[model samples]
Target: MVRKKREKDQEIGGFLKSIEKIGNKLPHPAMLFVLLSVIVIVISHFVAKNGASVTYFDAKAKEEVTKSAVSLLNKDGLFYIFNSATTNFTGFAPLGTVLVAMIGVGVAEWTGLFNASLKKLLINANPRYLTPIVVFAGIISNIASDAGYVVVVPIGAIIFAMAGRHPLAGIAAAFAGVSGGFSANLVIGTTDPLLTGITNQALLASGIDMQLAPTCNWYFLAVSTIFLTIVGTLVTDKIVEPNLGKYTGHYKSDDSELSELENKGLKKALIGLIVYVIIMSFLMFPKNAAFRSFQEDIGKNTLKEFLDNGLIPAILLLFLIPGLIYGKTTGKIKSSHDLVEAMTEAMKSMGGYMILSFFASQFIAYFGKTNLGVLVSYNGAKFLDAIGLKGLPLIILFILLSAFLNLFMGSASAKWAIMAPIFVPMMSNLGLSPALTQVAYRIGDSATNIITPLMSYFPMIVVFLKKYDEESGLGTLISMMLPYSIFFLIFWTILMAFWMFFKLPLGPGVPIFM
Candidate 1:
């Protein structure tokens, strides 16, 4: 048995090493993006000269439009590219969000608050439950776009390291939950409306009078959240973590052991947290408050508005206030200058990310400007429409196709826009409801996110993983996340198939068949 186990371990290690070797052969991530941008520019010029164009329904515009390639090689294109370089880097979603969140994170880390508080909690808790907790948090963190990648992912690694486990395994688990199980949130996320709006537009354009509710797939989304949490937990414990072998990073476990003064500082931080929460409640709960009066949210879904607008600042403050008190109490910060220095130190760590963002932002911008992603998705959907696959097989194929395409296309709404117009109408004609189609799309869209290097947060995750393993690269991430992606895609497809078999309502009064 020992020999067999050793053989198995060797086999797994060999396979992973091979994958890493291939992945590492690729250029550095920043250069990879730079090369991709140049490729897009070349492809765009060729396609434009060839008059290659595609006409599809645009959900946002509520019309059918021809999408033609735009080459960045042209004078106008070159000028626009040059002009937008600063904006592209600055507007990169993860860039600003990560920097902002890290200000608080930096102070907390510098003062030893995160170490002390987490140490106190984990020291008393059972270590077995850590995987599920991280996974569950990742799933729920979907509501705050980019925040999970910036915050939960790194925190998961830190927590795991503190618990004497492989930090990369924790990072994988968190990224899976945050991206792989993205569509499965207990509460509706911004994705619900964005996707539903496209589905509804597709239905209307197809001459169907019915419209989809934002929560059309609520039942499936909520159930998948629970199942994914369970699956993610098991994969981390049984597959990913064991495969990681063990933690051998420089982040010392003894660093988390709280000193007496640090514990006292933690107590003060807790009190500050309580006061902050109480103040927030007075502002958020009351009908009339200075905070509420300043903002305008006509959509009645105050929760969405609050989460979308208020959550980040709330997260910033949640960390900042507690961090300030902790640092002062711990003697880590003697004055305002110390706090400023801490924030600067945090920004310093992100120097690598800032460079990565420049090339990545350019690639994303060039791709969008060329309409390459949209054209590919639209053409693929048209091909799928040409073939008349029906029933469960069709749904399975659709989910699988979505998962496959996700590796190339990262934007959920952009892919949905191209697919929805074609699939929603196509599926509805076969007696499957638009809600069912949307649910299948969601399942596929989410499951592959963790494994894709093209994802915007991909570089951010690499940066996080590098903190634990200096040489960790694209192959490392892909191999680590592949199991969760495959498990999620297959299991989610099966769950949706089961849901369809029962002829159940997808949400309140949202049936599977028209």
Candidate 2:
């Protein structure tokens, strides 16, 4: 029996090795984006020349609309390509957010606060629960938008390295939680309202006379938060870590005990962090909170607006203050010049990611300009509609379709806007609730996030991996993450099926069947 298990493991290793080899053969990340951009240009021209178009329900327009591919080979297209190059690079979503977040994290790292705190945490944290804790943190981070990718993922690596484990495994585990479990959260997050808006629009356009709530999937996702944590932890321990074999990279596990000064710094840092949290609480929780939206549409004192807009700066301050406190306590940051140098070093590390983001931004921008994503999504939905599938098979296929489309499109709300009008009503006709359809979409949308380069944060993750292993390439990252993706999709689908079979409520007062 042991021999058989060994054989199976070898086979899996061989398969992953092949994937790594093939993926690494592709161009460097920057060049790959350039190549993909060119491909999108060529394809858009060809499709436009043939006059390919699709008619689908537009939730925003509240009417059926025809979308045709815009050819980037045309004069107008060339003008746009040239005119938007600067903005494309500048307006890239992840670039600014990551750089800003790193400024604070950089201070923490430079002051040795991270190292000290990690060492103390290593001694205090139970080895048995560390993986689950990291995974759980990743899951919970969804409430703060992209905070997980920028903060939780790299910290995950540090935590593992401190524990004398593979840092890559740590990254994978956290990424799996942050991206793979994106739709599963204990609290209502920005995604809820974003998706619920589209769902209700779909219902309205279809004349259903029923509106879905933002918390439509809350109950199920809350449960899934725990479910995915267990699954992610198991996959990390049983499959991902073992496949990685052992940590043999530039990062060595630091088992050194913290000195008295370091201990004092950590205590000071903790106090600083608590103080920061309390201040933020006062600003956020009050009826007339400082960060609240006073906009007529969103209403006054809305915490959601703060979460969406103010959280990043708050995070920056969160780390910056604690780091400064820790640095002062340890005499590592003696002056203003030291603080500037720490932030400068952090930005220095991000130089390579910025270059990659420029090309990636163009590729993403070009793809959107060409309207290929919309065209493909509309056609895919139409194909699914024509297939006349029902019951479990239909639900499973919708999940698969959403997962497939996720490879090409990164925005969850955007994709749902295009798909909801079609599937929500189609499923309604088949007696499934729109909430159930949205649940299926979320499952598919999340499972593939780690593997897709188009995802805004993908380049940042590459940079993180390179810090530990300079030789790590797209293939290396993909091969590492594919297991998590596959297992997540498989088990998440099964969980959905289980919910369906049991006739469980998807959320508060939201049933699986209409």
Candidate 3:
């Protein structure tokens, strides 16, 4: 029986190895986006020349609209390409939020606030609950933006090693929650506003007058955070930990107690955070307040405006102020120069993301301009309508499709920019809510993040694992994570189904069905 199990594991290893190899052969993410942009251009011209167009009912316009290909291979298109290059990169949706949030995060990180706080957190944590704590922390780290990947994931390994457990299991658990649970969080994160912006844009492009709230999926995400935390803990303790066996690496745990200055810094940072929250609430909750109003449209007043227009900067300040306070208290920032350096380092890391965004932005813009997304979605909706696949089953298929697409594209925002315009309208037409489609996309995107080689952080995860197990590679990382990914997908989907059955809202004013 042991031999049979070994043979099965061998087979799985071989399969994952093959998958990694094939995935490695794909072009870099930026190049792939350029290639996709070129494909959209070619397809645009081809469709234009062939005079192919689709007539679909425009829900917002309350009329049948003819959607035709708009080729980007001509003089006018060339002008747009040239003139829009700078704006495309600058205006790429996720770029700004990531940059702004990371500034504060980078300061906190450089100042040793996060490190001190993390060490302090696990200093006295119960041995048995360590995995759950790590997993839950990973889920909550979403509120701090990408800090989860940069801090929590690696710290999980160190914490596990301190507890004499398999560090790789800790890494797996953290990565699963951080990436696989990326979209779900208890609090609004940079991603929430980022995605909502894109979703709202797609809605407008599709001529819908509806506004998508940043909190539209908040309730569902909070529930998902709890669910993923539990599942991640179980998988880490049972599946991933057992598979990894034990820690045999030479990496020592830095269990040094938090120093007086570090404790002081944390307390100062906490005070800053609490005060910031109070200020924001005062601005938002009071009648006719700075961030609230009585006369604005429902979901459009001061609070909504604050969320829609002010959320990104508000989050930036929230992190920046606390981080600054911590840095000053910890003596990490002797002057303004130190703060600037911290911001510079943060921006430095995002250089690669910016390059990728340049190409991805163009691809997204051209695809939208050329009407490819619209036509494809129209045809796709027609096919689904013809086949009578509406409701829950269709939603499940959309989730699977998103999951499959995620294997090739690592950038969540890029994938969603393309997919949302297609699926959102299509789902809306199918008597499903656009928010429902977005939720499905989020589910599919998260479930496979840990297992995909093409995921931006997949290599980083392997690096973390290799610190403990030199034999760790893409195959090893994927193999251990495969169970977590599978379980997350199954359980998350089941939860969503249950929610749909109960007619529960996915978020504030966001329903499952139209």
Q: Which candidate is the best by lDDT?
A: 2
Candidate number achieving the greatest TM-score relative to the actual structure: 2
Which residue runs of candidate 1 sit more than 4 Å off their true CA positions? Answer: 1-12, 255-257, 285-306
TM-scores for every candidate against the unseen true structure: 0.94, 0.98, 0.69
Across residues 1-514, which tens digit of lDDT does each residue of candidate 3 receive? 9999888766755665565455445666567668877887888888988887877545334345687889888988888889998897788665675666667767776777766766777677787899888888888887656557756787788778777688888888888888889998888876776677777777877877787887988889899999999999987776567655556777666667888988998999999999999998888777767876443324444454455456667766776887889889878889999999988987786666677767777887787678765666556545544565778888887777677667656567756765666677767887788788888888998899888644544545655676677656556676778888889988998998998999999887778888
List lDDT for all candidates, in order: 0.86, 0.90, 0.75
Instruction: Sort the candidates on TM-score, descending order.
Output: 2, 1, 3
**lDDT against true structure, model 3:** 0.75
At residue 278, give the lDDT of candidate 1. 94
Model 3 residue 467 lDDT score: 64
In angstroms, the error of model 2 at 336 is: 0.2
lDDT of 2: 0.90
Tell me the spans in candidate 2 whose CA falls farther than 4 Å from its real position: 61-64, 295-300
Model 1 agreement with the true structure over 1-514: per-residue lDDT tens digits: 9999889877876776778778878888889888888888888888878877898878767888898877778997899789999998888877777888898888888777887888898887788999999999999988876588878999999889888889999899999999999999898888898789888888888799999888899988999999999999988997788877867777776643667888889889999999999998887767664355333423342455565666677788889899999999888999999999989999999998889989999888888888777777787777778888999999998998898888778999889888888898889989999999999998999999988767898989988888889888888898888889989988898899889899888998999998
* Better candidate by TM-score, 1 or 2: 2
